[model samples]
Target: MPADGIIAHLRTLTHDEHVEVAGVGQGRRVFRVDGVEIDVIHRDLGRHHVGQCGSCALRDRCVEGFWALRVDHAGGVQPCLLRDDLRLGVSRLLGDPAGLASAVAEHVAAFTEGTL
Candidate 1:
């Protein structure tokens, strides 16, 4: 299938490579190469429909968690798409590495075994 082809191609990426079969909704594959992440999106499976977000402390009632690292909107960039309060202007996001890392750490900490 197409996924097999994608896997085969991914295996060919040599040197400083780590692959994570991502467990998020739609279940993409993430290739980490020298600290950079390359995500390959696949078909949706609705896995997160009843998981992850439900268990996260940062969310409130069906709010999606970790669906995106950052979303670029017409207004600005948002750390979490569902949370308007987390919005950050491009310059702010670029300038605040500590804030970015904290946000990412919080999201990472929220990921459960079912969603990791």
Candidate 2:
């Protein structure tokens, strides 16, 4: 999709109590969803890092270590949003922003009911 379309869709998805668009730029966006900050990286811009390394589970290991498989987005990994089951739901929407919005809404709703 076009950049504008993506941005618009993102804004719509995040327009809720559980999610909000924190920032935006070319090929990138940041979201604050359900107390977790999510950075959506769409393309490689030659940058080797993103988000906070301090909170990463694999922080003790080298950058080329085993965690690389899970943390590596197109370019680099950012601090992941949520954890465990919630993270799984969000992770499934990495490439599809529209689906992400729907999933997030569902997740948030489920979370409120203590079911997520």
* Candidate 1 structure quality by residue, lDDT tens digits, 61-106: 4233445656565535543556565554445555788976675565
* TM-score of candidate 2 against the unseen true structure: 0.26
The collision pairs in model 1 are: none
Which candidate leads the pack in lDDT?
1
lDDT tens per residue, model 2, 1-79:
3345655666676753232222221134556566676545443321232233334464444222111222444332222
- Count backbone clashes in candidate 2: 0
Off by over 4 Å in 1: 1-3, 15-24, 44-46, 50-66, 76-116
**Residue 19 alpha-carbon offset, candidate 2, angstroms:** 20
Backbone clashes, each candidate: 0, 0
Each model's C-alpha lDDT?
A: 0.51, 0.41
> Where does model 2 exceed 4 Å of error?
1-85
